[model samples]
Target: MRSLHPLVVTPETAEVVELPAGGAFTLLADANHTGGALGANRLRVGPGRDGAKPHYHGLSTELFYVVDGAMEFLLGDRVETVAAGGLVVVPPRLPHAFGAVSGTGADLLAVLTPGVERFGYFRRLARVQHGLEPFDGLRSEQDRYDVHFVDAERWSSLRGGR
Candidate 1:
């Protein structure tokens, strides 16, 4: 268990990773920092860009708050567009995905409860997007990262099979 205390990450000390898909991820806190209580990061999505593919966490609840522009999200079997200042929460085992709206960009903050050390997962995402590693390499790491990929026909259709 982690001690009950405060955790602060200054901008100059935070880790930022650029993605080939455009934009970047500013990591705030990982499981280790929070004693597995929470994980947080800010995502800056480029215009017409996808933030994450369809996936689910078996043991964590993920929350996303749109800070700017608009975002498209696939929750369970529905697809919806949320604007800035909107918040979406997904409980464990619910498949979801998100991205910036076409022709527009998005900025959002994401948090996971009972945090899993996800900074490494985000780092691997950048590597995969940059072609430094194959996507298949991640298949074996789903459990370690607490992210399990799933096929979402609705999401595929919405992204036009991108």
Candidate 2:
């Protein structure tokens, strides 16, 4: 049974899950709502906040659109600074990570294609962020979420101790 209705997620109706990094992850249309076509969410980070550490999806491509402020992104071996109105698309298996540019807050919309039913992932992530659950608890679920964490030398050096 597939739902064919258009999905509408208003700000008030959307679920906002707070993260540990002075930020929040707003859950939007997920695979269940979109017939698995897309998974969407809003990621809002405070000044100098780190949104995600280096990781790559094994099955889903990711798209990020900076709606406000600036964001620093590590794509593969390069680090890019994208201002508001900027867009970055990452195909599956491409190492990537993001955070607010130093001293600035960042608001962005993130979408995953072939939606990965990731609401559970986001919720568990919040638990990890808030210390409700150890990161080790979430580590084993990465494969289920399609997110495979990996070390990126470039990202590590730049984000080290910061």
Candidate 3:
């Protein structure tokens, strides 16, 4: 059996940040700490707010667990509405997105197996390492860190076959 660490993380070590679409998220275990083992995150979306844009990983599997509030998942032609304590799995290369349906935003826990290299993506959006600044500023600094924007063509390819 695998041994469990008494304390792998603590409140002081948790990384928190505000995301796009007026949502906020916290990073429990990130790439730097996990050595790319996997990425785990907690997200809180306000009422009537959508989650991340419809996108898919080139080679990564992701899971989302709804901790509170009501959320709607959109995967291809199918739509699943889930409440607290529900889970959603998204396969790699499958376009999927979600949003809050209830008046109150939803609290979610997201996990990516084998790590999604999402840290690089979030870092590009954040610009500064310490805190999140303006999006325009982040866009300017993206290429400096070798982060490139995903154009519509590339995004479309991923969105297809959903």
Model 1, clash count?
Answer: 0
Taking the tens digit of each residue's C-alpha lDDT, what string does model 2 give over 24-81? 9999988899988899999999888778888999899999999999999999889999
Residues 1-162, model 1: lDDT tens digits: 774889989999999999765689999999999888989999999887889999999999999999999999999999989999999999999999999999998999999998998898999998988889998888899999999999998898898855
The global Cα lDDT (0 to 1) of model 2 is: 0.89
| Selected candidate, larger lDDT, 1 vs 3 | 1
The segments of candidate 2 whose C-alpha lies over 4 angstroms from its true place after superposition are: 1-3
The C-alpha RMSD in Å for every predicted model, in order, reads: 1.0, 1.4, 6.4
Per-residue error for 64 in candidate 1, Å, reads 0.4
lDDT of 3: 0.65
Give each model's clash number: 0, 0, 0
The C-alpha local distance difference test score for the whole of candidate 1 amounts to: 0.92
Q: Which sections of candidate 3 miss by over 4 Å?
A: 1-7, 19-22, 123-162
Best by lDDT: 1
What is the RMSD, in Å, between candidate 3 and the native fold over all Cα? 6.4
- Tell me how far the alpha carbon of residue 140 in candidate 3 is from the true structure, in angstroms, after superposition: 11
Q: Tens digit of lDDT per residue, candidate 3, span 30-133? A: 64556656778888887856665455665567899999998877665466789999999988667667778756689999988656445555644434333555
